[model samples]
Target: MENPIFKDMLVLELASVLAGPSVGQFFAELGANVLKIENAATNGDVTRNWKLTTEPADTDIPAYFCAANWGKKSLALNFKEKEELQQLYKLVQQADVVIASYKPGDAEKLAVDYETLRSINPRLIYGHITGYGAADDRAGYDAVVQAESGFMYLNGEPGGGPVKMPVALMDILTAHQLKEGLLVALLRRERTGEGQLVEVSLLQAAVSALANQATNYLVAGQEPKRMGSDHPNIVPYGSVYTCKCGKQLVLAIGDDRQFRKLCTILGAEGMAAIPAYATNYSRVQHRQEVNERLSQLIGQQDREGLLQQLQAQHVPAGAIYTIPEVFAQPQAQEMLLRNGDAKPGVRQIAFKVQHQEQAQLTPPPSYNNYKEDKID
Candidate 1:
C-alpha cells in the first residue's frame, strides 16, 4: 500500500544526540521508516545519560536521549567488523536519505561519506550536520556556538558578564534548520527524481537564528547590549512592575497608542499627559524614568488584577511563570506542552510538538534493542 506521506522513502540515520537525531525524528513522524544506526561499543547515543529526572527501575533510561530519539527504530552495529560495514552499505543503498554528524573528515575515515553513499544509491539525500562547516577545526558545543555567534553576549543584563542560556538553545535552533533543510531536499528530490547533499553547521545555524541582533551588529556598528527585559528601540517593552502579589508581568507596548492605553489601565493619566512621554522615541530616550514610574504605579495592584485589566484593553502582556505554572496554563495545554506519556516504558515529559493532531508520541528505544536479523 502506498503511504500517505512518504510512500517509498526510507531514512538511514547515523546521527546521534539532539540535532542529528531530530532530523530523523521529523521523518519518522511524517510516515518515513527511519533506521537509527548506533555504535555498539559506547552502546549507542551519548545523550542517553546526560540528564535523568527519574531513576530508571530497570537499566537506566537517558531522559536526554528520550527527548530526541522518539518515533524512530534503533539498531546497534559494530562497524569495526568488515561484515557490519558491508551491512551498513547495503542499508544505505536502500535508503532515500542518510544523515550523519561526524566531524569534517571523520565520515570519510569511516568510509560513510556522501561520495561513498551516493555511489551506493545515487538518489540518496545525504545530510551532514556539523559544528562548524567542513573547513573548521574548532569544536561545536551549544555553548561554544552561542558564544561564537555572539548570542551569549547580547543576552542577560547590560554590563554583566556573558551568560550561557540554561538550555541548548543553539542545538534546538539547529535542529529546526536541519529539519527545514531535509524537507527542502525531499521536495527537490520529488520534483527532480534526484537526491543531493544537505549541510547545516551549528555555528551557521546559531548565527542565522540570532535574528535582528546579528543583523543590527553587522549592518550598523552598534553592538546589541543586554538590556535585561527592555527592548533596545521600544520603551515600556519589557518586564515591569512587581505586583502586590510579587508576580512580574511583561508589558510590551509597541507604539505610543499602546503606551497611552497602558497608562489609562494603571490610572497614570498625568504621566501619559507629559510631553516627553508622548512619542515612542521620547519615551525610549527616557526609558529608565518611565520604567521607574510605571513600576511604582503598578506596584499598587495585584497580579491578577493588573493582567485582567491590561488584557481587557488588548495590550500584549504576560505574567512570568515557573515551568509548572506554564504547564498548568490552558493555552499551553492546548498547544500540547503537556504531552503526558509518549509510549510504553517512557515517563511523561513535555515534548515541543505544538500541533496536537500532528503529534505522535513514542518512547526512545534502548541502545541495545536494535539487533541484526539475518534476511531469509
Candidate 2:
C-alpha cells in the first residue's frame, strides 16, 4: 500500500474536549503519528466521563470522548512531575506539530507554551486554541461562545429568546480553522525550514462563520433577528411544512424559477402571478403570507408521496430527519467505520481525498494506554 500524506510526521496533542483533539484526529487519519497527552493525575480527559445514559459499561469512557480521539495513541503524564515534564519536552523536540487548548496563561504555567517549545525545537509547528483571542483569559466553552458571538442571538424563532445550538458548533468550527492554519504552516515550514505559531479561538471562528449574516450587518446596517431556520435574505427558504402524517418537509426555494415551480407543484400556479409573490424580494416582504399559504397546501398532502413528487419535479426539498433517521440514511451508513464488533464506531473522515488504500483506524485508547517504558 502507498504511504499516507503525513507518513513520518508526528503530532503532540495536548488539548482536550473537541477542538484540539479533533485537529489531532484529522492528522491521525492523514497518516500522522499523533500522541495524545492526557493528565494521569486527573484521570485524563474530562470527556471520558461525559456519559449519555446512566447505564454502566465496561469502560467509563463515553462516546463523546471516542468521537474525536479515534486512531491516536495515548500517553498519560502529569506535568507537575518534573520527570513527566522532561519527557514531554523530549517528545516536543521530536514532534512536527503541537496542539493545545489551554486558557490564556495556563500553557505557560504548565511549561508547554509555544514560546518555550519553539525555543526547544525551531521547526515545531505550534497550534493554540483559545476561548477568545490569545490576550483573553476567559475560559471559552462552546455554548457560552455561541451566545457571545451573536450566533445564539440569530438562532431561535422570531420574537423568541436566544437559543444555544444543541451541538458544540464553535468547537467544531474552531477545529477546522486550526487544521487549515496548521496545514499552511507545515507547507511554509517545508520552504523556510522553520515553524510558526498558529492560533484560533472560538469567538473568532464563530464571528467568521457568520458569512452573509455578518456582511448584512456591516454593509446594510441590518441587525439580524432570530428567524429560526429561515434565511434572512430569502423568502420561502426557511419554512417547514407539516404533512398530513405529521412529518416535516423543508423547502429551499432559491430563486424565482424554483418558487414558480413549487407554486405549480402545489396547484397554486396563480400564486406566482400575484405581485407580492412574483419575485424573491417581494416574497421576502410577504414571507408570512407565502409561508401560511404554502403550509396550508402542503399540510393537505402525505409527506412521503409529496417528497417523491417534489423530487420528481426537481425541487429542492427534504424531510427534516431525527438523529436516528439521519444515521439510517444510505449515504450516512456508507460513511460509518467500525473496528471489530464494537457497539459504536467512528464515522469516516469527511474528506473525499481518494487514496490507493483505505486508512486503517483503531478505537480510542484507554487511559494511559501506552506506558512510559514504551517511549523511545
Candidate 3:
C-alpha cells in the first residue's frame, strides 16, 4: 500500500459486500482518501454478520467484512435523514470518484445515482456494480450466477453433480472488471475534463471470463464437460497427481516437448515412444492410458523431492497448497496488509510502482467509526 499515486484524491464508497468495497479498497491502498458510507438503519454491511463461531458475536468488524474494507473511514447514515443526505452531497461536490453497488434503482431512490451526483460535481467518476445487467434486478449471488453462466456445469469431476466454486468467484471477477473500467474512466476524465459512469455486472464478468471455454462451444460446436483438473486442449496439462505423502501436485505441460520431458522424469519415456502417446494430440486421444500410467509412476515418489526435481528441470508443476500454507510462504509475505487488531488483509494492487514511502495501513473501520466529523 506504499504507492501514493492517488494521494489527495477523494473516493466515496456507497457499496458494501465484496465487489464495490474491493474497488474502494483499491483506491485506498493507492493512497486515495476513501470514505465508506454505510446504511445505519441496517447496522452497516450485511457481511459484518458473516462470521465464524470463533469470531466475537458483539463486534461489527467481522473478518469477512474486513476482506475489502481496509484503509477506509466509515460513516453510517440513515438515508431517510435529510441532514445526512445534505452532508453526503456536500462531500460529493468535492469527490473525484464514487463506487456504488445499489442493485438497479436503489441509487435513484436514494437520490445518489450517477446523474444526481454528477450534477453536484461534473468531474466526478461513478463506478457501479450489479448482480446482472442494469436492467435485470434478480438477486445475483455468486452460486446462482455460476449456475447461470456455465461455470458450475463445467467445474467438477466427470459424471458428478455440478458444483459452485468455494469462493465468491463472480463478485471477485466483477470487482476486477469494475477496477479496470474505473481506471479507464479516470484516464478519460483526464482528457475530457468530465467524468463518466462505468458499470459492470456479475453476470457480464462471469460470462466474459469463460474465455476459451466459450469458444469451444461457439466456434467448434463442442460442449465442454467437467474433466476435473484436466484440460481439454492440452495433454497432461491441468492433471493432478498424488504423491507418496498424500500431497497433490498439478502439471501444466504446455507442448509435446514438455510432455516428453515429463515422461522422461516419470521413468515412462517408453510411453512417449509409442505412436498413440508420442504427441500432444495422440496423448489427448489416449488420455486415460496416459493418466493411469503417469499416476502409477507419480504415486511412488515423495512430493517435496519430486517438486524439486520438476522445478530443477523447468517443468511447469506446482503443489496444491492449502489456504494457510499459501500465506505462510516467504513470497506471500510482501502481499500482507496489517491493520490494527483485525486479522490482516491482502493487497489488492499486485503490481509494484515507486511512490512515497508508506505508513502502516489502517484497519477496516467499525460501523460509523469516523462519522461525518472526519470529512473535510
Candidate 4:
C-alpha cells in the first residue's frame, strides 16, 4: 500500500479532555503516529467517565473519551517526576509536533511549554490550544467563551436570555482550527525545516465561527438580535411551520425567485403583490408580517404534503429531523455519519469527514495501556 500522508509524523500530546487531544486525533486519523501523554495521577483523560449510561460498565468505558481520542497511543507520566520529565524531553526531541492546552504559566512551570520544548527540538511543531488568546490573560470555558464572543447573545429566541449550546461547539471548532494551524506549520517545515508555534484560543475561534454575524456587527454596525429560529435577512427562512405529523419544517426562500415559487406552491400568489413583501429587502423589513402569513398558509398542511409542495417548487426546504431520523436517513448513513471499527466488536460513531474514508474509531483504551510501546 502507498504510505500515508502523515507517515513521517509523530505527535506528543500533553492535553487533557477535548480541544488539544482532538487535534492529535485528527492528525492520527491522517496517518500520524500520535502518542498522547497524560498524567498517571489523573489515570487518563477525565472525559472517560463524563457521560452517564444505563450499564455501569459503560460509565467506566469512557464513551466520551472514545469520541475524539481514537487512534492515539496513551502514556501516563507524572511531569513532576524528574525521571519522567527527562523521558518526556527525550520524547519531545523525537516528536514532529507537541500538542498542549495547559494554562499560560502552567506549561513553563512544568517545563513543557513550547519555549522549553523548542530548545530540545528545533523542528518540532508546537500546538497550543487555549481558552483565550495568549495576549489576553482571561481563562476560557465553553459557556464563558460563548457569552464573551457574542455567540450566546444571538443563540436563542428574540428577547430570551442567551442560552449556551448543548454541546461544546466552540471547543470542537477550536480543535479543527488548531489542526489547520498544525498542518500549515508542518507544510512550512517541509520547505524550511524550521518548526514554528501554532496557537488557537477558544474565544477567538468562537468569534471566527460566528462568520457574517460578526462581520455585520463590525462592518455594518448592526447588533445581532436573536430571531428565535427566524432569519435575520430573509423572510420564511427558518422553522416555518409544524405539521399534523408533529414534524417541524425549515423553509428557506433565499431570493425573490424562490419566494415567488413558495408563494405559488402555497397557493398564496396574491402575497407576491404585497409591496412590503415583494423584494428580499422588503421581506426582511416586514419579516413578522411574512411569518404570520406563511404560518397561516401552511400550518394546516401535513409534513409529507408540505415537503412535496415545497420541493416541487424548487424552494430550499427541509424537515427539522430528529437525531433518530438522521440515522435512518439513507443519504446520511450512506455518507457514513456512523463510522469506524477500531474497537473490533464495539461500534464507533465518528464524525463525518467530507470526501474522506471513515475515521479509525477504536474503543477507548484501558488506562495507559498504550505505554507499553518501544518509545518508552
lDDT of every predicted structure (CA atoms): 0.77, 0.87, 0.88, 0.78
Off by over 4 Å in 4: 53-59, 334-361
Residue runs of model 2 more than 4 Å from their true location after superposition: 372-376
List TM-score per model, in order: 0.89, 0.96, 0.96, 0.90
Q: Which tens-of-lDDT digit does each residue in 1-376 have in candidate 3?
A: 3547788899999988888999999998888889999998998889999999998899888888888988898988787899989989988988999999887998899999999999999999999888897898776688889999999999999999998898898999999999999999999999999899999989999999999999999998999999998998887999999998999999998887777787788787887789988888888899998899889999998999988888888989999999989998877988889855667788887787765555356898878888455454
Candidate 4 lDDT tens digits, 1-376:
3445676678989987778877877777666777889888777777876876654665544556766676677788998899989988888878999999876788888999988999999999999887887776666687888888887888888878888888788888898898889889989999999999999999889978988787778888988898788867667777558766777788877889898888888888989878999999998898888888887877767888878977877889998877779767865565332236443222222454455543443445566767553542
Alpha-carbon RMSD, candidate 4: 3.1
The predictions' CA RMSDs to the true structure, in order, are: 3.6, 1.7, 1.7, 3.1
**Clash pairs, model 3 backbone:** none
- Candidate 3 similarity to native, TM-score: 0.96
Give the range where candidate 1 is weakest over 10 consecutive residues by summed lDDT.
343-352
lDDT for residue 312 in candidate 1, whole number 0-100: 91
Top-scoring candidate (lDDT): 3
User: Given candidate 2, what's the lDDT at residue 128?
Assistant: 97
Stronger candidate by lDDT (1 vs 2):
2
Q: Please provide, for model 2 over 1-376, each residue's C-alpha lDDT reduced to its tens digit, 9 standing for 90 to 100.
A: 5678887888999999988998998888887888899988988888988887663565646788887888788899999999999999989878999999999999999989999999999999999999998898999999999999998888898888999888899999999999999999999999999999999999999999999999999998998888988888998886789999989989999999988888888889999999999999999999889889998999999999988888888889999999899899988887676779655655526766665355577778888787654333
Clashes (backbone N, CA, C under 3 Å), per candidate, total: 0, 0, 0, 0
